[model samples]
Target: MRKWGPLFAVSLAAFMLLIDITIVIVALPDMASDLGSSYTDLQWVMDAYALALAAVLLGAGALADRVGRKRVFIQGTVLFTAASALCAFAPNTATLVAARALQGLGGAAMFATTLALLGLAYEGRDRGIAFGVWGAVSGAAAAVGPVLGGVLTEHIGWEAIFFINLPIGLLAIAMAARLISESYGDREARIDVPGMVAFTAGAGLLTYGLIRAGGHGWGDGLAVGVLVGAAVALAAFVVVERRTAKPMLDLGLFRRASFVGIMAGGLFTQFAAFSGFPQVSVWLQSVLGYGPVKSGLVLLPMAATAFVVAGAGGPVMARIPPRYPIGGGIVCVGVGALLLTMVDAGSDWPVLVPGLVVIGVGIGLSMPPMSAAAYASVPPEKSGVAGGALNTFRQLGFALGIAVVGVVFRAAVENSIDGTPAAGRDAH
Candidate 1:
């Protein structure tokens, strides 16, 4: 229990931040209505948080390693809590978007150090259990976020969602400060400012292009330029890291198959979840006409399956090679996603349940072990960098997933419209 305190504390903060990711998604409509927003405003609200997180995560991780994880975590808690308050009180769309970016900055600091803290706090088997527990908390947060947001938005208004983070963040900060021991990364590591700059800018460009292109149209000159610029910047980042004496991110981590596989798993996990859930919510509300409460309740099986499997799977993970849980998880996701294609426009709960549960279970199985694998692949001194890398891949996966699905869905819609008369197509 003593060893678990920091892990739980960090997990609490992570859960709060991740929940904020999907939570705001559910409140998009309410926020748009209240702010008298155009489509662009809503996109900015969502994109701001993600982009900011991606922009700073590697830097935040490197900073945490140098400065001390506990110190970074405590500071992040304060910043995130304050940002949440700002978001809650924002008078309009612009203010809310700005506040969310601030929240992401805080979140990045907190997230970057979590696994590092866990790795230091526990050893071997205990570390495995800690990852499992952390993964369970993350799974639960992601699973419940949309429903919680819906309930809050339906009853308490959109501001309530952001306001809800205040207490959680404060509690996490207090607990983390008290329980987590201080730790630093490599003792002799120097700040690699150029590498950090290139990596951040490169990742930021790629992520923003993937996200913005979904809505702005793929052919948009800015999006194309952003994508091209991302490629160039990332190439430069590689060059800088290879030549620099002290690099923020070591390029060698990718050499290990375990590390690469874990990264791939993380990406695939987010790809499946984001590709399915938010879009399905639209179908549920717009097509099936389910209320917020009902729609939320309907997702309970998916959430619960993840929670249960993750908690139980820890011991199992300790006994087996990580490949089973991680690979099996992806396979489950693939199969689940395929099953979801059977969901006709007129489909009901029975059609949705199988796909959701399977995907949830896959996420449950994969995330915990994948986390452990990534952490295990690196030296303790590099936990911060490894964590940042893992999350960056997952974030990229989320954006790519949304973009691919959006493109496919749009094509389908266009095809359907093409079948209609020219007048009807023009009306649409």
Candidate 2:
């Protein structure tokens, strides 16, 4: 128990944070109804968490290195657990969004240190076993999130989804403190404050702009201004990265075409795979009148199949060239997403199954190799940064995907009802 206790703790953190990502999908409608949330507020409920995680992840990695991995991990777990409590008790959408963002910040800290802690705790074949178990836990989190959320939301209430994290988190913190030894990287490493700020601001502003534009249209002055601000902040991020001594993200990485491709693949893999689910959940509950449990069940095939494939085929995928699996897998995801577009107003949940399965297969095929490929793309010294950057892009992709899809979905709905009686009808 002592030997594997660190893996258990790290896996607990991964499960909590990753599960939180999709758990809310099944509970969104209930939350909106209780909190009087608008569609934009609903989007923020998801976006705020993802944006914060994406923005802070790299910085969190650096901070963990400078401080101690176990220390930061514990701090993050405490914050995340506290924030989960706040989320459960939030009185309104605004407060809930704030709490969720806090959760994201904490999640970033824990997430950025999980692998490092595991690396420090295990050796050789034991390390491989730890990683395998961790990977399984990560996938299980996704597979179980919606279903668990559904059961809790339906039987207990939406608050239970967030509330459930508290005990799990506390257990993790206890195990981590006692079992996980502290580890550090280069003591002289700088935190790259300027770059962190610029990247966070840029990502946050861009997400806000997208959500605003989705609600108010591109001509809205505030939306346009926010978008411009995002552009400026992102440009500043590039400049700061170039000038900073020991930058958070090394700009030289982009020079390698393989690295660039791997990063792009990571981004789109997440976007195409998971981002549309929130809206899909809303449709299941609000439009189709399906109960939360049924909705979660409908979504289970994709995650479950992905879990199975990744576990069973991991060895075969390891032997293949990274491109064949990653590229072909991404293509599968694209085709799967395309299949989903075939749905009409009369379509049932089954319409989603084929696409979901294909996407699952794609995810399973692509995910295992992505990290290994990312590490291989850069020099051994730079592999950590490369891994961090890939995760950043993946999270950013999810955040942006939700916003972008919301805008397009809203436009399509409005267009469909442009001259119909429904065009001017209000829900009240």
Candidate 3:
């Protein structure tokens, strides 16, 4: 366990950051009431974080390589913890939204470096186990978000959701400083400023348009223009990456199908995660009237199962080709999503548990192996940038998943209410 210190530090830090990604879902209802936010505003509360993370992660990773991963990682902890405080005391929705964006910026820095830290600490079979453990912790944290969020939001108010981060972030920061040794990805890697600017504009604009279009109708001219502008900027970014001698994103990673597939797996896994969890939470609280604790308990099976399955996947991965286990895991998640679609307004906990378990199992199986493979594909010197590259896709997928869920939810509700009485709509 002594040798596990740095791993524990990185994992704990990651857990705190990952928890924030989904925790706000359960708190949204309370925030809506307190802040007088519309559905779009509530979606922004989620999107703002994802957008900022996606925008800056590539640069953050490169910065880690140029300077030191531990230095950037510690800085991220300070910024994230401070931003959480800002969020807790936010006076209004706009303040909360801005704070969330800052939190994401901090999270991007940590997210960019944690995997690199893990890689530095472990090797060969040990690296595999570390990834399994990391995946389990991350999967469990994400799965548990709504339940924790529900408990906090229900009892202490929505602000408590942000407040909950205070102790965790501070403790993680302290532990990381003491236990984790400093490392660099590449001392020679210069910050690619122009590449950073192009990717940030491209990713941020596109995601904003998607979030808006999901909450509002696609007919909005602003969404259309933003999307088009984003496309043009991303095209420009590709040109910049190809031309820059030391790019923020190594455009060359796309040359390998295996690496691209591993990254795609990250994208799909996050897409599955965000799209399903928050939507289900909305169904549980708003449609079914289950309280936070009870709803959380109902969702516990998935988290528990996922944690176990992820730990187990390491052994299975040792014997099989990595792709097989990863593919199998994604397939399990899809099956779970299918089962969850059968849920109705009056469905009980028994009806929900099976699907959650299946998805949990799938997440456990896929995330570890895919992550391991992603790290292995790049040279160790590029670890921070590589991790960032993979996560950029993951967070972008997360943002898109939320938008898709919002669109589906809105459309479904509109259709459900089209012919209903006003009282029935209110009751619904």
Candidate 4:
């Protein structure tokens, strides 16, 4: 137990943060009913956390490298625990969304430091064991998150999902303080505050604009203005990255074709596979009238398949050229998305099984190699930055994917339900 104490601490933090990514899907409807949330509020509820995570992830990494990984991790754990309490007690959708964003900031701090802390804590065979176990825990988080959330929401209420994190966060903090030692990377590494701010502004504005366009039309003056601001902010982000002395992401890496491909693969894998999940949960509960547990169970095949494939096939896939596995795997994801198009007003839950399984297979195949490929593309000194960049892109993809899918889904639903009996029903 002593030998693996660091693993326990880091894995606990990883599980808590990663599970939050999907745990809320099954509880969205319950939250809506309780909070009187609008459709846009529901979208923000999901996107706000993801957006904050994506935006802060790389900067957090840089900050950790300078300030000490263990110290930052503990601070993050404390903040995450406090934010979870805020989320549990939030009185409205706006407050909940704000709390969720705070949770994401804490999550970023923990996530950015976990691997580094593990690297510092272990060596040789023990390090390998620690990493393998941590990887399994990370994979399992997604698989179990919804089921756990469903059970908690059904039995204990939606707030239980957030409240559940409290004990886990506190335990992680205590374990980390007792067992984990401080470590640092480039002590001079600077947080790219301007770049983070610009990128976050751009992404947030873009999502807001899309949500606005869904209800108010693309030509709505406010939507158009926000979209234009998004463009300006994104452009400013690019400029800041190019000019900053120690950027969270080194923009020069994009000059490499392989690096670009790997980044794109990382981003779209999440977008193609998991982005529409919140909307799916909404359909299951509101349209199909499934309870939270049943709705969570409905999505289990994909995550289960993903876990099995990644564990079983990872070693074999590592032997081959990464491009084949990553490329073919993402293609599978796109095909699975196509398969999901079969879901209609009259379809049952099983319609999702085949698509989910395929996407799972894709995720299993692609994700294991993504980190290695990204690291290989850069020099040794830049490997950490590369890792941070890949994760940032992936989270950004999830955030943006949710916004885009929500807009399209709303439009399609409106078109299909026009003058129909379902049109009069509560879709929110």
Candidate 5:
């Protein structure tokens, strides 16, 4: 119980950080109005964080191992707290976006360390339970982010969303310093600098291309150049990884079929889940004419259901094969999207609840098992790298998901508007 206390506290911090990633979406309008920014700037407010997170995660893990995980974790907490304060006080979109990017840097440090900490603190069933709890807490945070963001934005201001992290970050730092033990990965391995650069460049370019294409069309010259640059950079990354003595992400990990399948499943599940939420939130606000707080309230059940279901996955895994949960969970996500597809301008809270609940349960079941499976497949020495790689893919998937779904939603909204300009204009 004593050991578990630190694990729970760190996990809670992790949950808070992850939730902050999406929570700001509900408050975007208020933020834009307050700061007097354009839509592109609003998109930057989200993308900048994600880009920094994805860019630094693998390198951050290696750095954590080289230094001390506890030391790095505390540093990350301090940085995140400081960044949150900056975000709270940001006077313009540029400042807010810059602060968010710094926040992501801190978040990447903590995220890379926390999973490794979990690996150290618990074993077997206990470990499974810890991971389950981690997933549940994270899912719950994501679920409630909208509601919480909405309430804070409405009652106080958009700044409350960023300010809220200060206490949580401070508490996490204090607890980590006193309670957590130190851990590290293989220090002897050489850093794959070229691979890291190539991968980061590739991912950034690709993400930029997708996002720009969504707004400006694929024919846009900048979008076309970005896409080409991404492809070239990715090819160079593969080459660097193959030629390098020590690669950040070992290509050989994919040889194991179970690992490959589970990783693929993880990517797809995140892609689906990440894409669905923002689209739903937009529909709630733009189409249904709900205030941010009301939309958040409507999302509450989804988060609660995910928390309950995800926490149960650990116990269930003890009795059943992981594939059952993974497959079933993926199916549920698909079904939830299908239900969301049925949404129209007139749809209400009751009509949305069941689908959101189903989606949450599906996500809860899928995420933990996939993570556990991926972690378990690697050698103990390589767990840090493997975990880093898995998270990188998941982040990549999330970035892509947002781009893809934003495009879809934009197209749908435009088409709907084209059909009836008055209705579509009203909806926006």
Candidate 6:
């Protein structure tokens, strides 16, 4: 019980951070109206956090190892809490976007250190249970984000969604202080400055290009240049990482079959399923004529179902073969996405509920085994990097998923725009 206490606390903090990623999506329209944001700015509200998260994650793990995981975790919690306040009180889209980026920075620190902390704190069955609980919390949080955002946006304000993090953050901080002890690795690696620069720039350029292509046509020269530059920067990143004595990311982890497959599956599942929630939230509110609160209520079953399945998944995995649950889960997620494709302007709860449930279950089953497999395959020395890479890929999947899905959904909407006269066009 004592061993599991800190694990629970860190896992809880992770749950809060993951939840915020999706919570803001449902609140975006309300936020836009209040802040008077343009469509591009609204997209930035989502992208900025994701970009910052991906940018800092690789470095954050190394920093945690060099400094101390607990120390880094405390600093991150403080920063995240402060950033939440800034986001809650933000007066303009610019302020909110900046705050969200800060929040992501903190989140990267928190997430990167979390699993390492868990590994340090627990052993064997306790470790398994802790990770299982962590997985359940994450899935449940993702499932709840939409409903929570909707309810908060409708009842209090979009700001309430950000503000709610305050209590959770505070509690997690207190728990950390009480339950967790600090630990660090022996080797101290130098910062891979060039590698960080290349990776961040490459990811940013690619994401920016995708976002722009959603608004401007694909033929737009700036968009084309951005994408081209992204490819070049990524190539440079690969070169830089290989040559660096202390690489920000170890390139060797890809050699393990289990590691590679788990990472790939994680990316694929998130790319296919996780990206669709925000779009679904908007579709429910704008197209289905559902109120924010109602939209959230409609999503409650999905969250609830995921929580249950995810909680049970660990025990289930104990008895079953690893490949069966994970592979089956991936298939379930893909099938759910296919069903979701049936949703349109005229769809209702009946059409949305089944698909959401399928997705929730699929995600619940896939994530834990994949995560466990990734960790199991790595050498103990490289656990930190492996964990960071796994999370980096997961986050990258998220960012890429949103960018790609956003483009597809936006294009679909634009193409479907009927002969109705263009309404109040904003003065450029």
TM-score (all chains, Cα) for each model = 0.93, 0.89, 0.93, 0.86, 0.92, 0.91
lDDT of each: 0.81, 0.78, 0.82, 0.77, 0.78, 0.78
Q: What's the true lDDT of residue 426 in model 3?
A: 22
Candidate closest to the true structure, highest lDDT? 3
Q: Cα RMSD to native, each candidate?
A: 4.3, 4.1, 2.9, 3.8, 3.1, 4.2
Colliding residue pairs in candidate 6: none
Q: In candidate 3, list every pair of residues with a backbone clash.
A: none
Candidate 1 Cα errors over 4 Å, as ranges? 410-428
The total number of steric clashes, by the backbone 3 Å criterion, in model 1 comes to 0
| Cα lDDT of model 2 by residue, 95-121, tens digit | 999999999999988877776676567
Task: Summarize candidate 1's per-residue lDDT along 144-240 as a digit string, tens digits.
Answer: 8888988998899999999999899988988898899999887677888899899889988998898768766789789899999999999999999
Poorest stretch of ten by lDDT in candidate 5: 417-426
The per-prediction tally of clashing pairs is 0, 0, 0, 0, 0, 0
Best of the two (1, 2) by lDDT: 1
Backbone clash pairs for candidate 2 read: none
Model 5: per-residue Cα lDDT over 1-428, one tens digit each: 47787777678688777888788988887887899977678778887877777777776776776667778788988898899999999999999999999998888888777777777778888888887888788778878899899999989999999999988888888888878887766777776778878887887788778777766776889989998999999899889888988777777877888888877776777677666676677666666667788888888887888789989777676456788888888898778766766776666667877778888888888877776776777766556655666676777777778777777676665443234423332233
lDDT of 2: 0.78
Clashing pairs in 1: none
> Candidate 5: global Cα-lDDT?
0.78
**Tens digits of per-residue lDDT for model 4 on 1-428?**
87899989998998899889999988876897899986667767777788677767776766776677788889988999999999999999989999999999898888777766766676554554555456556655765778889999999999999999999999999999999987666776666778878876876677567556655666789989998998999899999988888776678878888899988988898788777887787677666667788888888888787777666665566567879878888898899888988999788788999998898778777775665576567554444455567777778677557656766787664433232433323232
Q: Stretches of candidate 2 above 4 Å error? A: 2-4, 119-133, 375-384, 411-428
